[model samples]
Target chain A: MFKALSVREPQPACADVEALSETPVETLLELIDKAQQPPWVGMRAASCLIQGHADAVQDTLVDWVQQEDSRGFAILVLNQIDTLPQPVAIAVATQALAGPYASDATSRIAKSTNPALLALVP
Target chain B: MFRLPFALVALILLPGCELLTGLLNGGSGMLETRTSSVQSQDGIATIDVDVSGESAFQLTATSGQLLAVEAVNAPDGSQPLYWDDWSGVNSLTSAVWLEGKDTVLNWPVRQADGNLSDGTWTVDVAVVDDQGYYTDDQVDVVLKLKDDSDLSTGTVNARIVYADGLKQDSVVTAGVQDAVTRWAEIWAPYGINLETSYEDSSFSTDQPFPGEGSEQAEVSSGANGSEITVLITETIDGSTDYYGIAGGIPGTLDYTDHALVIVSWLTNAGGDGEFSDDDIRLFGETLAHEVGHYMGLFHPVETTFDYWDALDDTDDCGGQSACESALGDNLMFPYPVCDWTSCTPQDQLTSQQAGVNQRYTGTL
Candidate 1:
């Protein structure tokens, strides 16, 4: 994952994100915490976690959504997810409606392909 | 030592002298454009351009073959200039040698003293490869000249392409349109008006950056005519880290994949993942900067500090602090100079820089 994220070209670096979906939830969380370079690794890691271990990292994702620093990455993860669980979808829509990032929330909701998340968007 | 065939003659004449003089003396800064087509026989085509007292002049040559501006001759047929003249080491020796189908030659040609190489200029175009000239290649050469009545104004159109579902209508205040408005204001000082139109793309939210994959080329498939294409996507190359990238240094206006300017949605959001006033400002700068590259302007000085662009007005200040203080305000400076609090405004363009931008084939 480190090697993959370190590469400058985004195609390979981002392709590695899909492979990391099989990685352990704890390992993925650790990688996200330590990821810095390329500036998008944390967001990609969050995406990987959401894709493979949504139930396991659900609370952590919710917590990230509420925080200012990590909220963008968390929202980006939600934006890419093919299927958002009912609870996570409700939590994100509520937080998005009542935050400094309401515009970002609206943009994400408008572009989301997931019907459940789209239905939840106000 | 090569003489241009007499068949080549000036297709367009200069505007009236009084109006031109008034233009130089702060009158209406309208732009005059002349376009002519020549058929290459035995791999070479030549044309002549007549110049008067225009404030600035730029010539663009486009063909389907690998193209190069073989030579240029002054009106009096003296002091002929050739492709080999530019070493590209300094302002005086540098030139815009675009390798693809489209190429441009801005007048003045690196003269720091601002000497315009005006009046009956002869230009030679030829098909060539790394090995040698390709004589059998026959193609149509389209030459365009943009003559600015004054240094104060010019205009170029932009075609904005949005990835699937990312299209923000003209009324959308917070997204691409707002940033484009800021982009226009940044160029207003140079008298370059960036007129714009919008389109929708069938591509997904996350696609390859320009030159990364075929998607960008596909996105640009709809591009036609002289307007530049700007593609807005959620993430380029599956990552939101990149601010934007241009397909070429002086990207072509003809409809080809290599002629694209792309921006990332998340990268435009800046660090906060939300569009603040500062982020919007940065977004606007990025759009202008990237399009500046597409229009053939290099960084006044690269991030390395040792290298510099081919312009006289821009200083060659080396090291971090000196470069930051000297060139941080220029539009084409590499990377924004920012602290934890704020970033410096990069909105200035030297006369030569603006000349190059206006010289682009797309800058109508």
Candidate 2:
């Protein structure tokens, strides 16, 4: 199946932005859908703010991390989290992101948990 | 400026002291239309607004009470953009709208206090267009009588906790923290508070001799509410077996108010590091993006629920190559591309997140 993954809320879905930069994993990360609209902006951003949709997506993409803390993974939220209990959300994402941990090149590269990786940061 | 009869204007505003009285939404500064007319037996006042598309609108009375909104259709099937519920309206939260339909929003509620309610309020609404950028409209209302939530009380509060992981100074650590902080500000208006200890600590315990460490963010919520714990790591070396993993590294874990757990890993080593950036922007996005997962959010180009059938039929990244075409050119597109010299070209936060930030922190 096809999918678009991102980090945080739709306003700045880091997943889709970094999709191009991402090293493909044999195990899929996410699927693509219409409710997400503009494709660039995920469902989260598509359902809330309508102003400067492209601009918002562009700004989020232009901003990338040179210095990274290689600890946990990132997740993309595609729904309205307000009415729902926050604790529920935290629990869901943890499991989802961790599920794909071992199938990617990064996970393979990180097998040794090498400190050299930090030095490798640009 | 489209104007109606003077009586209609008076009919709409004169009842400042009515059971429930207020505009459906603040003037977007985008467009406007005013009308005064028949406030029939429905006990609800109807204000004919001027607008076309429908997403969601929020209005605040001078009483500071929130008036939930929906853009729906009128009885005539003309599909209105606004409406008012003065007498029998219940909590505005009761509204549910269906897409692909033309309609006007119907919302208004009378607090239990008896007297009319009024105050300053900022309306958090979603344009529901392509990107869904968080948009807001602020307005003031005055009540002829004062009605309260019974206790004659009113005040809403919220909290923001930084996802746990990085320390205050380490380049990677600090970079992560700063990024989350900025995200909190963006979501403040949603009544979420942004909290960070800013203390210098690490999540990775045994980093590789020459490798960067790891970290983790754990989110928890209950009667005490929600909080994220960022766990940074110590150092380690990668000169060992291809399969032997070492000490703890930065790993992200997201859970719902306690639902699913998403564990992620990061690094900046050989094979063209995807970690670093021209700026800390990626780190910041990572913070917010990951948090979105813990919050029960999924990906945009969803392959699961069949949510992508009607799209432009392009790839996720919106680029020419398979990597780009697969994920498209947007940040939240779908795929994660790793090039030593590139970054996500179309990344950005969803609109609701912007509202979440605005509702509390009062910043972007």
Candidate 3:
């Protein structure tokens, strides 16, 4: 009359995106650039960038938009471009539209109500 | 590169599209279900499950106290089975023993011959007390069986819920629909058809995904009848990184508070506004994977590598490399096997796995 118990593994803990909010903008960018980090880490880092470092990360975001590997995360950041300052949003979208992801960039820009960003679409 | 051939091979191995076509044409529909109350006599409950020319048979026992399968004797009084005894070794007679209120047994699990041995089989059940001893208790068991003589065809209804205006967002809606189509294809081989519908809602939750809370309770309560409700949210608890999670193994088709499945739109989209081809494939696999859990399929080998499912066909492969090599393409692998470039499609379901899905009480 031996009984066996069923055992299941718990899911791994998700990376703490909130913790990265306090990280330096440079460190967040570095984290995003690290190929070893899981895609989520780069995504969380991009969120941290948009929250407070949009102006500083504009160039880097545009660079990621051009690259194949990081384009998805960069596009993710642009999805919330409305949260950034008007000037920074335009700057990033302009550079993004010039990249290989032009169509994707155009769609994200077209959704914006900002006149400056929409004018750049056509 | 290396990903293309694997993808092509997976495509070649997929069952004919006719399975889905037949379902759309109104072939064998959802399996019918019957629930019966079994009272314990001297700490054991004897119940009879009549196959009666059915394609398959599944018995799920639930009680206020924990329940376990103590014996299963066929019509000939042979193959006396014990719970979790020689499990994964004795595939035909091995039973799954879970220390919970509910346990389901699907006949012909992992049996290569697919012989259901139709007859009125007697299953003896017993309750385990708080201290893990056999105790007398009344148990309610539900039997899900396919109709008449159809062995390989069954339908599952899915109601996908869009939260935070995701359904209104055309990009998200198209991506989700594409994923659902792919999910149907993945299950086509097992003759399991996914009849999908969509819903729109706004649910705000601050808790992490899979955490039990009022918000999840409210979402799960939306499920009724035989459809499994899948709720797609913006990002679980403010992060867009985690994949989807199921409320429980075998989430109910009833109007209970714990009968929901959850997927994150942003995570499935890889945080992008639009989903790429790879994103769609991953999303489809995620949908199938999570729904598999809701239908009572466990990961062949858990992430810990030590714990394994109760199935005989799934190997107890250890370590990341070993498990990936062994069960990477399995539909219920713990996570997607991928590196810098692409992921291997996790679309394959073993016979036992398919049996488990078909045996789910919600299949109706």
Candidate 4:
């Protein structure tokens, strides 16, 4: 169960502490650095789009999609998207997985067998 | 350190062309309320400004009306919150403000190169905080634009319900009500604002042993203060098809007293389809854009374009993959015959910047 946090930029975007993966708080700065690299390239930067649009965080990635990747998108598959400690984050993400890629052939991403997330976050 | 004169010249010149930040006109003219506060909700504020106050503020060039804007966010003084009105969008910046508003304390709009219409507008400062209802709480700011003989006008006061089409207040996220709120906000800059009563579109989504279907639901908002009333009718007998439309200017509805009706096919529900964020934003954009036509705005590039390409097409999330190139990349892109997402979030936001109540501009 490995979750990856992808941030294209630091400071206001990835920052420190914003990555609350249950126990510790570390800057996803490393995640940003890693996700933008190979093996992760073309591998949708999940938060690359969400992180850039999070409350208080400037939505630079949304524009990055237009100016950078016009057709394809960058996403990050995460073992966990719950740091907000609230279920709304999962609800929001569920709304995400429900749309766009809901029909993608990737059975893992589409069906979302892990109903555990819905119970945990909301 | 060495070239002090050059440094001063560069700094001075940059201030004049600061782009979206010019809302203040380098003075104290621009007053903005932040919608960055977030509450326990997923990520949307339920707010509605009383735009129908008895005391009207004449929108002169120098002194515009007073408006109280609201949004959903964390309470003030706790944490700095920043949110974009447009979510579910992939290409455009959902949040539009100056690069450093909290630091510099100046709110600006994010207008990239491709906004076809003139989108130099500012966020209204009514609510002053970010945490608001999913529907925006707005001030009743009355305005009168210049008299353009060609400018056709109408009002669209509505209460959008689900396919059953009855008035139900159960709230659904990223629902049709949210879509319409976004539309009205886009049309806010224009003279089209949604009525306060119907602002929050928390319609009922209840079901029953209910031999009823979601797809064949007749969802239409109640008509009140609007000259034009719009209703979204669904025709599926199963778990009905749904839609989101902001009734104000962003709905792109220009009629003063007619219902710019929107209908969705029965099969569009959770029935398998890869819905793109681009498509959602575009759907919100296009439906309103077409409604704008109902209000009397001509197509930006209707000469060689066709709106009929989407008559029965549902493949590209209501978008016609073929007509993107022929039409001028704008809200009114001329292809009205399909179901693909036609309008972009930027198009709606930019259109909201029109400011129809900003008094009759001699230049405009």
Candidate 5:
């Protein structure tokens, strides 16, 4: 049985932000799953994924949003996707807005400066 | 020789028309008036008005009111300010009365109704007889209000991380929620509300107490500029003496950022075990106290200076025993004791405390 430890400090992510960009998509997905272990680390991983592998990260986030157990974390990830490249970020945000996480996705998209992303808001 | 103004001489002589015959006949002699230099401190104005050859004098305000006497120079140790409650009035009229001649009447000026603001004001001093007759020889004194901004409102987001085993207990979750609710109610007047969430962790139960080694670094990691992160566990380094510990001094960056509370200690402090009413109350108060520090409130006597909480109304007990007796129920007191049936109301936040708390910039 895992001992219950309430850790207040942020855990060191599996990889640093710079190294996370070069890390493989599978590793990034695993880090996203680590959101259950320590939420902040997962948030940092998601940020790295959005900066590094936007397209793959977008697809993974959309899939996570589709799942019942992972939807909350996926919404948090989608919120961080604003830093992604315009076209890829727009596609991920559009899919998120069309899914169960539409409200959160719409809010994130509303903050974008890209016309296509802004147009998808309504 | 320089001559006095006719109007001034007339004012001195006429003395409210009724004294005309007395002055002409030299029946009661003449009234002499002298005012000292005015002094202002902490939004209060004080001055000394000396009157001789008059039975009594009345201090009237053109804008503000003559509040309580903060100090006096009288030899008899008599308080000059008198509070009079009139039958038909809703407010008490406070005034400075001079019973005899050659006494300096110290007057403190404060806001009256909505007339006082951040500017200079003039107060009128007139002679009054036993029959309510007022003299025309009125003197004007000036006062100024201090410039301090009003208090503001803020939001707190509290993240409660429980040990994995404790997180499974429904009682723990409910108790934590109740505690947060109580804290919100206590701070609602200050415009502070704790938005709380709980999480279960898989880390080891060997977490260090706050301010020891890496614990602070770890705990503060979850903290953001706008919210506080509270780590609740079964015990704090397995100590029962302390129910909760916060990081840093009040108004500092570290203090506003993180707090660690031990739920087990709070619950079992009186040997009643978990989920008891006393446990819930203690838990809430502990959280409130720690967060109070996060919001920049120091223990009334814990500061480097003597007996300072920066508020005038809250009592200051110089030492531990005195505090336990006189200020035992103060929320910011050093330690609190409780039992299963009832607990002390150590949860009250004074208005000045609330003002200091609301001045922090850590709101969402």
Candidate 6:
């Protein structure tokens, strides 16, 4: 008999940011590359990488935002990481607002309590 | 004076009495011996009996409620069953007046204890006159136990119809089955057992998201006839659309038993290098959510909003606007996250929801 789908493993990207910090950036990039492919392993990888190495992978994150397949995940990662430079964050937010993630990006921008980010909502 | 005459006639006719003498003396008002037998349909037993006399009669059951009562003489004359405060009045009592003729009374029986048992049951019918003189008669009824396993079980015929450009993968097929079966297990305690079957097929639509046309096409393909038909596609309209969209209430559509979930959303949602447990669970939760809609469930909202599922026990978010805070981790919450290792109480169906799910006619 086929085994039923079970949530046996530790929770995905959101659970342990500390554990994600140990994952290699190359592997994370590979995961992001296949984000549109089946099985959604890439999305989980992207979540971990973005959560753990958002500051270190800024250039790669920018590249992701330029592609149709990875833009949504890239925007989600950029919006979640607080440590990223304010200028880069604003640029990414601006791009997300203009792209398919406009509603989600707008909601995030409107909810941001940061003075600099709040000013960019409109 | 009447008593003295009746006693004198009974004494003289003790050895050889005519039927007229018995009727006049009220000694044998029972024209026929009380006999009863039960015939069950849809888990309820109907007790049929013939009682005849020239007096008023009361029928009482030992252990079950009379669901319905009907008089044979006036076929349309049926009374709702009600019970008196008698010690053994476990069921109902029907006080009927026979106009000096034979009448058949039908009593539909339902177990009061909620246990389906097979054995002999008894009913008592007593005939009484205006003067309070009465005679009692008893009848035995036999009921057979029914098979209860299939009471709430249903089937889901999952049809995985990928978009024109997408390739079919066995892993995705197995994962979809796993999700549906897991939902079945979650509902097992509430008497909902779901059996699922999977088929891999494709459609020519370039639109990633399925619209009404897609649903119509899927239904026309004869997917899961009368059972739930879930169409899993690679994408919906675009990669950015909703993860899934389910029809509201089972019978609302002409097809009546179909749902559409996006496998591409599942893939896009997971950034992991491979399918993880959380990924599978998220997929399962999405499927369960759509099926919940098909099962007549709505979002738990407490406001004047139109989308409220209308169940009381489910946490009622004030409205769509307050759903983010009030919805919490409820399974029927509009946008639930599946990042937990195990399901919470909020993630499972409330008792009322389980009942509704069991009562869904589409799955039946």
Best by TM-score: 3
Worst 10 residues of 4 chain B by lDDT: B3-12
lDDT of 5 by residue, A1-122 (tens): 00001111212233433343454566556644542332223344554556566776566756755554544345445545556677666667777778776765776678777777788888
Per-candidate iRMS values, in order, are 6.4, 14.6, 8.2, 18.2, 16.3, 10.5
Clashing pairs in 3: none
Two-chain complex of model 3, DockQ on C-alpha atoms against the true structure: 0.13
TM-score of predicted chain B, candidate 1: 0.73
Clashes of 6: 19
Candidate 5's residue-wise lDDT over B153-205, tens digit each? 55556667776465765656787788778778777766665567667764333
Candidate 2 ranges with C-alpha deviation above 4 Å: A1-122, B1-169, B181-195, B199-224, B232-275, B303-331, B337-340, B350-364
lDDT tens digits, residue span B1-364, model 6? 0110011000001122221111111111121112233333332233432222111111222222222222222122333232222112111211222111121122221122122122222222223233433322222232111122233444333444544423354445566666666666666666665655555455542233323454544543454323455666544443322456554332121232223434443443443212446556656666666666655565554223333543556554454446645664556665442222323333566766665554443333
Whose DockQ is higher: candidate 1's or candidate 4's? Answer: 1
**How do all models score by TM-score?**
0.64, 0.30, 0.64, 0.28, 0.40, 0.42
User: Mind giving the per-residue lDDT tens digits that candidate 4 earns over B276-298?
Assistant: 34334444554466455433233
lDDT, model 5: 0.44
Off by over 4 Å in 3: A1-10, A14-31, A34-122, B1-26, B41-43, B58-61, B79-81, B86-100, B104-108, B112-118, B202-224, B235-241, B247-255, B309-316, B350-364
Tell me how candidate 6 scores on lDDT.
0.41
* Candidate 1 local lDDT, B169-243, one digit each (tens): 322225577788899999988878888888876777676655566676666767645567888877766555465
List the candidates ranked by TM-score, beginning with the highest. 3, 1, 6, 5, 2, 4
Task: Give one digit per residue, the lDDT tens place, for model 3 in A1-122.
Answer: 00000011233222333343455676666655552212344565567677767787777766767766555666666677678788777777887788777876887789888888889997
How many clashing residue pairs, candidate 3?
0
Model 6, A3-89: lDDT tens per residue?
011111112333332344455576557544633332344445554556566677767666565555554465445446344567667
Shift in Å, residue A99, candidate 2 = 34
How high is the CA lDDT of each candidate model? 0.61, 0.27, 0.64, 0.27, 0.44, 0.41
Q: Please name the candidate that would achieve the greatest lDDT relative to the true structure.
A: 3
